[model samples]
Target: MLGNGLLKGLTETARNFFGSYVDKDRLTTIQYPEERAPRIEASRNFPFLVYDGTDPQAGLRCVSCLICEKECPPKCIFIEKSTDKKPDAVGKPQFYPTRFNIDVSVCMSCQICVEVCPFDAIKMDNDFEASATGRFSDLLWTKERLAKSNEYYHHIHPTEAADVDAVLAAARAKAAAPRPPAPSAPGGAPEK
Candidate 1:
């Protein structure tokens, strides 16, 4: 029965070979570069910053916390907190990054930066076609280049974006709600 396994494998090969004509799914081989396979949602290549509004610089959500930079295993992320203040979506003054860079050549794409980001400012990008002629200069992405709109984030990660939106909405609602006046001192008496 040692040859039985070999025969079974050959049978599968024959079925696939013959089925290529009748079954569209059976044809796995294709002309790449002209026609590419669809990328799955979970596939991660590099980390990118997400912005909330039209202006990438003004709408940036990174509070310059440096959490992602500290957590990155490959030490590919770099950031510099800006001295100037900018109002965020909530109308609070926040410090945006003056210079944020990621070295793609040294980056291992481990998704650790995405995981460690508390602000949800960092997310793994699905783009894999980053070809650079010069490794050091061309491969380095700046803050301007790394920032993508929330819509772009939604386009790339719909499910994750939805979840993040829900959480943000809840937080905004909580922040916007007026706090109930502190209960009057015991027995409806005001204490000095």
Candidate 2:
């Protein structure tokens, strides 16, 4: 009983070692640059801001609500709301983030920012190649560097992006729908 656990671990190691030689499927190691494993759809590395269209500044989905910044466990997210308002994706006048930065060195890739964002403006990017020589300055990603188009979001996360698009379409439809005319006051009200 004492060495059973150790024996099991050893057995697994031996099996894997022998299996790698016999079975190609059992081989886990790959040449780093030339050959790489297929990326998992659910894999997420860091946070990036999602924008609607061509113009990163004008089409930004983030309303600069500061929710992500407040909710981030590591306090890596920073945002500065703009003084003037800009029309968001839904054509509503909303304050856009004038200054947004995320310190990747400090961020733990917890996806809390993406979860807290109500506007669907923030999403986890699968780009894991964020290595930098300098820890502080090089890793601090700015709004410009972090802004990615909706198409890119769809490419990285198809299912989730499609769902988000459907919800947004419904919202847009609701906003565009006409309102019923206001009823006039009782007949005699205007008769002096």
Candidate 3:
């Protein structure tokens, strides 16, 4: 019975080995670099900061909350909040990251950073070729290097991007919606 199971496994391997020659569809191998396979949309590599509009710095969605940095398993992400506030993608004044860095070498690509980001500022990038000659400096990705456009995010993960866009759009609409006037007290004072 033990030998029978081994024989079955060998038979399947042999069948697959011979099938490639007989069946053209069975030949799955492709020439790397020159004829690379199509990228899978759901495949993720590393975390990238997503910006809304044309300006990467101005339109960045990150409010420098430090949630992603704290939640990062490898402690790869580092962030410094700005003193002054600037308008974000939704035109809400927020404190942006003055200094943001991610050590790619230490990162395990677990997508935890992306998951914990409340502002939807971070997303997983499909770029896998982050090779470096030097160990330290090259692997440490600065805010400038990490910032990517929303269009690029959409291009990589269309379905997820579309959903994020819808949610963001709803938030924008809610923020833009005129609110009812605050109730005033009897003696020309605003209600607490």
Clash tally, candidates in order: 0, 0, 0
Q: Model 1: clashing residue pairs? A: none
Q: lDDT tens string, model 3, 13-128?
A: 99998998899888878977888777799899889999988999888899999999999999999999999999987677899999999999899999988888888999999887
Highest TM-score model number: 1
Choose 2 or 3, whichever is better by lDDT. 3
TM-score per prediction, in order, is 0.80, 0.78, 0.79
Clashing pairs in model 3, backbone N/Cα/C closer than 3 A:
none
The candidates, ranked best first by TM-score, are: 1, 3, 2
Please give the distance, in angstroms, between residue 167's alpha carbon in candidate 2 and its true position after superposition.
0.8
Off by over 4 Å in 3: 1-26, 180-192
- Report the number of backbone clashes for model 2: 0
lDDT of 2 by residue, 1-192 (tens): 899999999999999989888999987778878987766789999999999978887888999999999999999999999999988765789999999999998899999999888889999999877788987889999999999999999998999999999998897887789976878877758755
Regions of candidate 1 where Cα sits further than 4 Å from its true position: 1-25, 180-192
For 1-192, candidate 1 gives per-residue lDDT tens digits of 889999999999999888888899877777779998777777888888999978887888899989988988889999998888889866789888889999988889998888888788998899888887886789999988899999988888889999999998898798889987887677867657
User: Residue 32 deviation, candidate 2, in Å?
Assistant: 2.1
The 10 consecutive residues of candidate 3 with the worst lDDT sum are 183-192
Best by lDDT: 3
lDDT against the true structure, per candidate, is: 0.87, 0.91, 0.91
